[model samples]
Target chain A: MDIPRHWRLRKQRYGLVGEVCESCNAKVFPPRDICPECGKEAKTLYTFSGHGEVYSYTTVFDAPAGFDETAPYTVAMIKLDEGPLVTAQLTDLENRKVEIGMPVEMVTRKLRNATDERGLLVYGYKFRPVMN
Target chain B: MTEKIELLKPQRPVGIVGYGAYVPRYRLPAKEISRIWTEGQGGLPVTEKSVPGPDEDVATMSIEAARNALKRAGIHAHQLRAVWVGSESHPYAVKPTSTIVAEAIGAVPNTQAADWEFACKAGTEAMVAAMGMVGSKMADYTLAIGMDTAQGRPGDPLEYTAAAGGAAFIIGPAENSVAEIEASYSFVTDTPDFFRRAYQKYPEHGHRFTGEPAYFKHITAAGETMLKATGTTPEDYAYAVFHQPNAKFPQNVASALGFTREQIKTGLLVPMIGNTYSGAAIIGLTAILDVAKPGDKILMVSYGSGAGSDAMVLKVTELIDERRDKAITTIAYVERRTEIDYAEYVRMRGKLTMK
Candidate 1:
């Protein structure tokens, strides 16, 4: 990933910041300016509570480039408490099985190592089993 | 006339308004480490050590802890005037971990950010600076974090104990504090006990030299100084915590300082979580605060290689009980763990590079 591109998405990547539509009262993730519900401009920033449950999940044995080191990792579609489904990698699994409705919480983590040894480290949010 | 070196106190009394600790969920048991290297024949230093997942690092863990601190402090991130991270294993060599933390917590733009290093005591160094900032009223609140994903040579003695985890404390005025800082003392000297040159993958210690002349000397001096200057004895403190590189070091040090096992038990977590380096002492303090009652006096001491110690006396306030449950407790992080084998540990720690 390029530095500027990653930098641009920092708010979303770091804090789960997204848009909330006033017209339809919908929460939009990935922060699209236009609301999917009302087709209106939904630019008000809202930080997710980072609490969610696994809507669906898959364990990736064959990892993508820049992620081979962490192969056999699980990626899940999380249904946020606020009614948005976001795709993220589930971490801190500790060998436990991931169920469809397991509760999880957001945590900041290294998304991947730098593009190269001299490149920048990419960090983002991942979900883990909630402690409580 | 003789010069006097007195314990340092904030002008207006500053204390930990909120505090949080993070221990990675993964555990690499000592026997697992021994199984690989020592054929499971050696006496282990600790029962287990916390291991950062492939994705976790100092910056990420620090952010988690800081968020917890913010949540417990009941304040907006923007209200923070500074964010200082103390660590030896900052993911980036040149970039500042403090900025990443500040930005993640939404404290950027208006926050003074920097990183501090003093070996293991790096966290308390930041804590001392935070005291100064909040004490002088230069900042209403400041965040100081001590976190690390410390590494050791593949088969070195340090490997068994070098671990991942840390704690964050929000320093503010006494009125809002959960624990009021009464006084602090620092003892430092030029000593070459441990070093990891720039770009080095693992740190090298001076074998037994790390003890006696380094950890013991500095910690004892700072501990005794803080006690004498405050006109308090070890018996006065309800609890005491020390920088724990392993279970033995803190136990030994506590005994030497006149603190009994009962006084040190609540804060001695290294046996279960390994040595979190910069996070060692502060995380222990967090654990102590987890169950401490109002009016409970606590003593804390942290030692860093190359070499120094920071000691402080804190008195738990009425706010402790009300605020402590606001965030995850240290014991919860400790219990919410899973055991990993040596092979998984190597994979998570990135000890084996993929071509």
Candidate 2:
């Protein structure tokens, strides 16, 4: 990923910052300016609690370009406590079986080593099983 | 007339307003490392070491710890005046990890940020500076973090103990502090105990030279100086924590300084989590603070390989009990472990070269 693109998404990537629709009281992730729920302007910034559960998940054996090193990792659709589903890679599995409703929490992590070894280290949020 | 060098104290009292520790959930057992290299020949330095994930680095881990510290501090990120990260394993050579940390924690635009290095004591070095910033009223609060995703040569003895994890501390006025910093002393000298050059992938050490003349000398000097300057004896402290390169170093140093096994056991986490380099001493201090009570006096000493030591005395305040449970405890991170074999460890650590 390029520097400007990464820089623009930092707030969303780092702290799960998204938009909340005032008209409909809906939380919008990936921060679209227009709210899908109410078709209104949703510009207020809201930081997610980062607490969620695995709504669904899958194991990827065949990796994508930048994520080859961490192939065979788990990716999940997380249902945030405040009502938004976001896709993320699950980490620190510690060999525990990921269930449909297993609780997880957000953590900052290197999303990938971008461009090349010397280029940029793109960091963002990744989720892990909540420590009990 | 004789000149006197006094220990560092903030002009006004400053204390740890909030603190947090982060240990990556992956574990690489010593025996697994031994199986590949030593064939189980020598005694393992530690039971296992914490390993960062393929996606984790110093910046990521520091942000996690700093968030936890912010959670416990009950303070807004914008209120912070500085964020200083101390580590040897910052991912980027030219870029500053402190900025990334500060931005992630939402302390940017108004905060003074930088990175500090003094080998393993890098974290404590930041802590000392934070005390100065807050104590001198230059800043109302400053965040100092000591953390590392330390690497070791594939088969070197350092491999068994050089590990991942760290802790973060927020220094603020005594009124909001959980533990008040009474005084701090630093002892430093020119010594070549360990080095990893500008482009070196792995660090080189002077073998046994790292022990007596480097680690012991500086730690003892700093420890004794702090003790004498405070007019307190070892018995005065409820607990003592020293820089743990491995389990033995802190134990041996604690014994030599007249602190008993019981006094240092709570903070001796290296036996399980390995040495977190810059995070070593401060992480141990976090564990001590986890269970420390009101009015409990604690002694902490951190040693770096350059070499030098920073010794500090802290008195736990009544607010400790109310604040400690606000975030995840150090023991919880230690216990939340996933054991991985050598092949997995190699893959995660990127030890194997690939085209």
Q: Write the per-residue lDDT of candidate 1 for residues B59-117, one digit (tens) a residue.
A: 99999999999988998999899999999998888999988888788898998999999
Window of ten residues with lowest summed lDDT in model 1 chain B: B346-355
User: Per-prediction DockQ scores?
Assistant: 0.64, 0.63
lDDT of 1: 0.92
- Kept native contacts, fraction for each prediction: 0.67, 0.67
Q: B242-286, model 2: which lDDT tens digit per residue?
A: 999988888999989999999999999998999999999999999
Q: TM-score of candidate 1's chain B against its reference? A: 0.99
Looking at candidate 2, what TM-score does chain B attain? 0.99
* Superposed model 2: Cα runs more than 4 Å off: A113-116, B1-3
iRMS for model 2? 2.3
Deviation from native of the Cα of residue B5 in model 1, angstroms: 1.7
- Which residue pairs come into collision in candidate 2? none
